[model samples]
Target: MAAGAIPATKLAYFDNMWAVQATATLLSHLETEDGRRALILDSTIFHPQGGGQPADTGFISGAASGFKFVVEDARLKDGLVYHYGSFENPQDDCVSIAKEGEEVSLYINPQRRDLNSRLHSAGHLLDICIRKMGLSHLEPGKGYHFSDGPFVEYKGIIPPDLLQIKSKELEKEANALILAGGKVSAPVLSYNEAAECCGGVLPSYIPTDSAPRIVKLGEHPGCPCGGTHVADIADIRNLTADAPHTNGMP
Candidate 1:
């Protein structure tokens, strides 16, 4: 509401990851340093690129106004979701067409979104497989869920001799669980409640007073996450753990 300040965009996808279309109000539009115009909305179904996932691409059309903005990329900065793209028809007064408080319709590319969600959920499924296979010692680390080479890294190393054996075992276990699929749920809870859902404690990086969102796969204990995921493990279809890559970590 301030001159150049925009409020945090409510994440509509957080409540419904399967939603591809949504209605939102135009909050602000500004040009980035790179010259790309960014559209901010009161709330967004667009999942900004983060949490090991790529951004969602889509188009926004103003209601009763022939203004069209193609969303090439979306990013979050300080809680604001910036829809980065340009107007369909460029003009000197392009900004004038996108008025503040005007209603707009948002539609995401469903095929791309589904693929991203499947890949992301598979990464978490791997974490579950690791725990089930008695490899609980390997601490979960960063994950790259991009379609090109999606992988979940761990903090510990797998010995060279056992790497091949473990890879096969992991792949078998992952697919087995996928066949025995279960529902997945993500909910926002208080720090204490979230810890209980996440087995016992949350990561230290999470603030004590903050209400963290926890994603739970079926009856398994939950994990703190802030990304869209499939409604069920079965939706992941299948999983194949290619090989284990280890660094020189102790």
Candidate 2:
């Protein structure tokens, strides 16, 4: 460690709730070999690539300037948040850079964020529905919440005869929750409290005494998570589920 250096990026998106437009201080910068220059922020409203969701892309500019930099990616590393993108530099067009410690405004692409959020939330809701199906034995696992083709993987096998029935039931329950307009109610809780919300079984990666971020749909039980989400259940539209392959999911 340095004699005196900040250890990592302070995250703001956790408390941002739903901030599409915000501001932060430029903490540092990096230029990748691919030619993309990434700006690190002291505190960020950007959601980094973690929790099975993709990073958020947006723009970072001087507090009052027209357009200083275009942020293309946000990532979390060792507690630091990196915003990767380019800017229109006044000095030259070849490269764009920002001074560290300068105040900068940030904005996330609304359309992209909306889709990502909805799908991510849908994945969570699907997990809950799976439990409701009396097949909790399936055991939830990895989730691909990307907008292109999102799905939740489970550890147990579904009897081949129940595939179609299960798929249809999943769609119906997921969509029912959407139409029901369940209010979102995610809150951070102490380790014990969080564990209880997750049915008293925290994921293996979570320490027994570590506080965790949780997400819940309306009155449903909350699950620990770290991804942006739609404000309400209704925000997720046209959610569908595909039948598990005979060979099972990857």
By TM-score, the best candidate is 1
Least well predicted 10-residue stretch by lDDT in candidate 1: 241-250
lDDT score, residue 35, model 2? Answer: 73
Clashes per model (N, Cα, C within 3 A): 0, 2
Q: Give lDDT: candidate 2, residue 155.
A: 81
- Residue pairs whose backbone atoms clash in candidate 1: none
Model 2, span 1-250: residue lDDT tens: 1212645776777786578888777766667567767777778888888888988887888754344777778877667776787776556433333556678898888888888888889989988888887878888888998877788888888788889888999889888888988887667789899888877778888887788898988877789898988889999877878887657432
Per residue, candidate 1 scores C-alpha lDDT tens digits across 97-136 of 7788899999999988999999988989998889988999
Indicate the TM-score of model 1: 0.95
- Give the top-scoring candidate (lDDT): 1
TM-score against truth, every candidate: 0.95, 0.90
Where model 2 places Cα greater than 4 Å from the true spot, the runs are: 1-4, 33-35, 64-67, 93-97, 248-250
**Per-residue lDDT value at 97 in model 1:** 74
Candidate 1, which segments miss by more than 4 Å at Cα?
A: 1-4, 248-250
**Worst 10-residue lDDT window, candidate 2:** 89-98
lDDT of each: 0.89, 0.78
